[model samples]
Target: MFKRLLLTLAFSSSIIWFGSCAQKSQTTADQIEKAKEQHAAVVEQTQQQQKLLEEKTRKLQEENQQLQAQLQRLQEEKRELEKQKAQIAKIQKFQNVKAENLQSAQCEINPDLGVPLNPPQAKPGECFAIGYLPAKYKYEKVKVLVDAGGEKVITTPPKYKVVPKKILVREESKKIVVIPPVYKTVTEKVLVRPATTKKVVVRPAKYKWVTEKVLVEPAKKVWKRGRSFLTHAVATRFDPNTGDILCLVEVPPKYKYIKKKVMVEPPVVKEVPVPPVYKTITKKVLVKPAQTKEVVIPAVYKTVYVKELVEPAKVQKIKIPPKYDYVTKRVKVRDEQFLWVKVLCKDNMTKDAIIKLQKALKSKGYYRGPIDGIYGPLTQEAVVNFQKDNDIPITPGAVTLKTLQLLGIK
Candidate 1:
């Protein structure tokens, strides 16, 4: 519908413009024809009248120039109007594309209700537009099953009482016992010592002195700053004095040989064996051999009791109840959407409203034009861009209610 309206208005404007242009062109032609006839008539008069005719002719030419300028301006204005239409068409196409995409968008879901969140339709006097609807939540305490019912097993141990009873452990028998041998002490004389050979060195060790060189210092290259011998001034390696130079020189280490004593030959020794030594000592001598004896033995007994099963294990069924609990869950109550909204246009727009709109857009970094209370091209461009960025209905050159609400304006 809007596109058709635009086309109709454009056609009407073109017809009117062309008609006005044709009328003006005809009038100018007629005026030029009349002026030519008057020039001919003036040429037939005196020379003085001819001067007046020339002046009039020049004036008429000036008027023609002015008319031509006006026509050029009209043409330029028509071009501008066409450009504006193109821009409007582009914006409309963009909006149509966006609407197509939005059609496929799924509605927001309410978690708690398990349904899509849909707001009530706008009333006649109210404006509805898409807006962020935060999720609502509530805390609740609910019962939840923690454990299920099951069977349990229980057992009782058997009873027991202790009583004494005699039992033979060993049988009676006659046994023979052995006695240890006895011994008598006696003194005897024996050899106390024998001859032994000792290890004897055949030759003594020999020693000699040898000379060896030991390193006293290592060789290295060192940097040395140049010094002024006359003034005894040594220049620093860094930030040196003028004409001073540093040199890296190699210095050889000095060493000296030293004499040390060392063994030249090892000593030799010989070993010799000798007879074993003996000594006189007092010792015991056996006087009797081992003997045995017989004796009577008694049997052994112990007390014990037998075990028996008294009761068997059994299972018990227990009915465990279910536990329950409640938790807070967020659920959407309403979702944002697009609807008919009142906007600031020529009908309701005012200087104050425009100024406020410009100020708001400026604050949101969308506008850079002066806040002169005029919805000029720059202001309109700002509004259209803002609407596009914010997903508001793209009302080019107009400020919608949703735009104002988002900008924090009442």
Candidate 2:
């Protein structure tokens, strides 16, 4: 029974020792697992903090790009404003000058000429009447009424022309950002907050945009010439694009589309033309009207005699003239028809035949008026006088063959 008790106690002690060892091992393993879990948590937290820092830096870079773009735009606007100001100053300088000083030459008056007419011859020792001369000379001294009076100066209506006004016009189309420049913008998002300790953080912002304007002077486009004519071509048409405004730009404005400049040369027609410029411009313009006013010249029908020289009343203008081929004259030849006297001239000759007859008669010394070779009344009379004087009498008429033979002409 003592041995049985000893065996039971030994078994119990072994069980207790084994159980204690198992408990100690299990506690050590649990402690190690807990340490591993804490280490993993620390690593995960460090990685998260690093990621947050990277995101913050990326946001900062975006904000910096946006600030740079804004700065560029402001600089561009400053330049444009300065240029515009310079142009305005130049225009002001031009305005100071007057329109009169810009003008050049002048038109003058030409004295009216007085033509001389024949006067009655003056008798000797008679009161020689004052006669008007052609051109008058300015006398330095006034003498007594001289024998010759001179022309008096008179004012004549001056010729005038029209001058048109030319004006420059400006047109503006509102600027539409057809192809607007795209750039980055910054937006902040709260991702994480410090867990260990809270500290106040203040940071200096980067790239603060300050707008500035620098003058970009417009190119001096000198208007070369302008037209001023009576028959004028005044055109007001436009497909024009004016100068840009003072706008700041990070990127240059792009052209989505453009309307090209079109030059239109006006059509010309048949009209009284005028010069482009004139020496002097007069406001008292006596325009010669297209239709005229008929002044009532007093119907002075006092004592007009119907003299030999009759002033022909103007008849409606005959638009056409009578075409003349030839004419046949009637003759009173009482003698027989003289069937054998039928004659045809190569070319009809009235003047030449008369001249031949006269020349033949002169050779025979029976003619005296003229060898003018004309078939006028003088020649006809001479021929008749010759026939009567030669005793070959015939009524007054144009010459014939027998009469020609008698005048020694073939």
Candidate 3:
């Protein structure tokens, strides 16, 4: 009995173990299925995320390409702007050079007439010796000198006279006569005519009646259904199996005939002539032509005293001495001569020097004008007076070296 009891207990334990193992196996399988399902769901979600990323990347790439194109265009524009700037700069440089050249060319210096040093200096033709310099120079030279001097004497001859003698004259008188014109009565005949006008007539224009025809409705295409003669069946129009007809029908337009007047010929004009009227009238006519008669005239004469030249006009020679005087004259020994000498000219002259000159003149009571820096007429006159008073050689209207030295201006 105990062995049987043991066997039963072992069998019961074995069955319980088997059942637990089956249950655990089933739980593990369920967990594994749930894990597989979750993994598949995550993988599908990852795939969707990757697709979205790819689409975003594609859009970004397209935007980047467009931006790059814009950048390239901007770069090209920048290059064009730089080129234009360079060209403008080059043009400005050329203009500057041209302006400078024009300024220089316009300010050309004259070589013959040097700039004036002082206002009072004698110009080229005034005095025996005049001072001037080469153009734009600081030195003086005598440019003129008289070549000759002379005096002339004149004489006049005595006057001549003519005399006339009187002779006997006679006077005469004569009787005069005149003729008068004569006229006679006369008669004349003249015709008087009057102007006449002719009558003119214009005929009315002629016309004719005509008729014309016009269309009111145009031709049209229509569809009609009919029974086929071969099949004896009615069908839709334009069907091939069914007997149908497509017909083009022209509907005549309704028109009415009416009479219309149209001018066939223009009007005609006729003119009738009328004879001119005339009338006769009486007038004065010349019978004998007018004549002029001459009257006798008597002549008178008278005698008068008259003067006549016995001798013809003749010139009498009278000896006249020439008028003479001991006149002093300055004669130039040499022609115009030039010699270079250190001098102050306009190019090197300063306002200070001019002021000093004016002051000096004023101090010596030679100048009565303002002490302006300009060497004007007043200063020139002062210089001349000073030179004259100091017994300095006077170069007419010129500021000479001797003059300057005497004034202590050198």
lDDT of each: 0.57, 0.40, 0.48
lDDT of 2 by residue, 133-230 (tens): 11111213212221122232222222222222333333433432122222334443322222333233343223333344433443232221233221
TM-score leader: 1
Best by lDDT: 1
By lDDT rank, best first, the candidates go: 1, 3, 2
- Residue-level lDDT tens digits of model 1 in 1-410: 99667555655664576468557644654454456556545535655564686588658855765665556556655765675576556555544443223332336433443324443553554433222212222334434333332443323223333333467757886554333345677877665446777677898888999998988888876656654342333333443465555555567887989998888997777867667555455565769863444545446454333333345444445553433333232233433333334554355578888888899999989999998998787887788788767766665535678788988877
Superior candidate under TM-score, 2 versus 3: 3
Off by over 4 Å in 3: 97-410
Give the per-residue lDDT digits (tens) of candidate 3, residues 45-156: 8667867876886588557656655565566557656755764464334233322232233244233434233334446533222332211112233322221223322222
Which 10 successive residues of model 1 have the least lDDT summed? 128-137
| Cα displacement (Å) at residue 98, model 1 | 5.9
User: Which one wins by TM-score: 1 or 3?
Assistant: 1
Reference-based TM-score of each model: 0.24, 0.23, 0.23
Instruction: Indicate the worst ten consecutive residues by lDDT in candidate 3.
Output: 130-139
* Model 2 residue 332 CA deviation in Å: 99
